[model samples]
Target chain A: DTAVSQTPKYLVTQMGNDKSIKCEQNLGHDTMYWYKQDSKKFLKIMFSYNNKELIINETVPNRFSPKSPDKAHLNLHINSLELGDSAVYFCASSQGTGPLGYEQYFGPGTRLTVT
Target chain B: SQQGEEDPQALSIQEGENATMNCSYKTSINNLQWYRQNSGRGLVHLILIRSNEREKHSGRLRVTLDTSKKSSSLLITASRAADTASYFCARRNAGGTSYGKLTFGQGTILTVHP
Candidate 1:
């Protein structure tokens, strides 16, 4: 069984359009995160949620928003998508907060293409 | 912004050879983690070494951390063709409210020839 899953593995949309990617984790993890991998393959954290509460918000644009309905789900919504948004979006989950020894498990990722 | 920077952005090795990747980060950290990502796939957790720890091992994978240098190294022994992938090092920022959040470095792509 897949531990972390994201819906619409491939998303192709035009500029000025809004889109949303859904992510769900069944590991009963308390923390979930959204990461963006650029063309150069640099992965950066965009947002994080713990137990349906927003915990970390990077310097991402206001056009991008993350919502967590519950501890098991975190969704990302992008408004007015731009060509620069073309990249891979990954969803990950971990067992606890703080550093220590928690390991993150990533999903298959959603390839977003903006034209 | 990227917190960690990995050396030798790309590596090519023959099967049975050992591969080593180095990661250096700025500022202190609670832990350092290594992950592997196959092309077009999500990342897979390889191993994590805490700040207090000096060395750790998992199977053919060995990880070493040096807090004094704020760097870490991952060594893969007996690398196989299947070991071809991008390896990334992520560090949990030490201070501020950003604890537990991981900042990843530019990955090192390793190609193991059969």
Candidate 2:
């Protein structure tokens, strides 16, 4: 079974349009994260939620929002999308919360294209 | 901004040859992990080395961590064509509220020819 899954593998929308991507993890993990990979292949963290509580909110634009209804699910919503927002978004989940290393399982990623 | 930067952005090797990749990170880290991502797929966890550990091995993958230098290396022995993928080193933040959060490197693209 797939441990982490994401919806809308590909999204093509016009500028100013709004879109949402859903992520779900079945690994029984408590921490979930959202990352954006730019055209240069630089993966940057955008947001993280631990047990449904916001933990890390990086310097992302206000147009992007992340909602975690539960520990197993975290969804990303982008509003007023611009051409610069064209990139691949990934979701990941981890089991523990501590200084000790915890392996994260990533989703297949959603490729968003704003025209 | 990325906290880690991998050396040798790309590597090409023949099948049965060993592949080595290095990663360097800034700041204190609880541990460093190696992940592999095939084209058009999500990343898969390969191995992790803690700050206190020196070397770790899993199957054909060997990982070494040097906390003093804040650097790590991954060696894949007897690499196969299927091993052609991007390798990334991620650091688990040790301080602040992002303890368990991971900071990833730019990744090294490896291509193995049969």
Chain B alone, TM-score of each model? 0.96, 0.96
Tens-place lDDT digits, model 2, residues B17-57: 99999999878888899999999888899998898899999
TM-score to true structure, per model: 0.98, 0.97
Chain A TM-scores for all candidates read 0.97, 0.98
Off by over 4 Å in 2: none
Model 2 chain B TM at: 0.96
DockQ each candidate and list the results: 0.81, 0.82
lDDT of 1 at A92: 97
Deviation of model 1 at A84, angstroms: 0.9
Stretch of 10 with least lDDT, candidate 1 chain A: A93-102
Look at candidate 1 and tell me the lDDT of residue B30: 90
Q: Model 1: chain B TM-score vs. truth?
A: 0.96
Model 1: CAPRI class:
high
Off by over 4 Å in 1: none
Give residue A92's lDDT in candidate 2 (0 to 100).
Answer: 94
| Deviation from native of the Cα of residue A110 in model 2, angstroms | 0.3
Displacement of the residue B89 alpha carbon in candidate 2, Å: 0.4
